[model samples]
Target: MSQEVRTVEQQTPSNRESAQRMALRPVFMPPADIYETKDSIVVLTEMPGVSSEGVDISLERRVLTIRGHSASQDHSGYQRVYNEYTDGDYERVFTLSENIDRDRIEATLKDGVLQLVLPKAEAAKARKIELKSS
Candidate 1:
């Protein structure tokens, strides 16, 4: 049996323009999942070989950014015949809504995975109130 390899299309100028517009929407990059509950938003991102100290998280103008880099380990003392994963920088951004409380956002890293908890603002949170008769 024989198998064939496929190549993906390269990014062109027109595609780049479209990408810019699409970037503003809620997005998830490779190895990442985002979910929103009634109370908060959760983001789980896989960042292999990246440490808590090396990860950078920032929020600006309702846009959240995550950046990290990984370097090749010193394999001089060992030998490897097979290698597949690439060692490079990783970056992702999210367009947060006004419902999120930027001041209360928190993030944690464990075992090369990053988890972010974005709580909704008090005013933005949905609530039910009792109505009184006049």
Candidate 2:
């Protein structure tokens, strides 16, 4: 599979110097899956080396954002060692719709995985109506 790295410079909001100051870009996300049911939308994301308390989730104005910082290693007594992967943080954002019930969003983290459950608004849910002949 092909991979893409989006630097802070590339995703700069508007200003120039502020973009430079935000140069510490987060690493690519491991993987994610989203599914919708009759009552709610479920989102699952894979995030290794991250604790439940370390992850942060927020929903504002129909926008959902997830940001997390992984635990760093303490290399104090090691003389010389080989490393393959670098530990870093993860951040991802998603735009929600009016159908979502912003007040009832719930999130949970377990076993290096994050799961979000977003319930749909009552008016947006599908329902059946009955009619009688007059």
Whole-model Cα lDDT per candidate? Answer: 0.64, 0.68
lDDT of 1 by residue, 36-102 (tens): 7777878787888777776778777666667655545548978877777656545677666655688
Any residue pairs clashing in model 2, and if so which?
none
Task: Give each model a TM-score.
Answer: 0.69, 0.73
Worst 10 residues of 2 by lDDT: 1-10
lDDT score of model 1? 0.64
Clashes of each: 0, 0
Tens digit per residue, CA lDDT, model 2, 34-120:
777778888888888889877888776666667667887657887547777667666666665545787888888889889999888
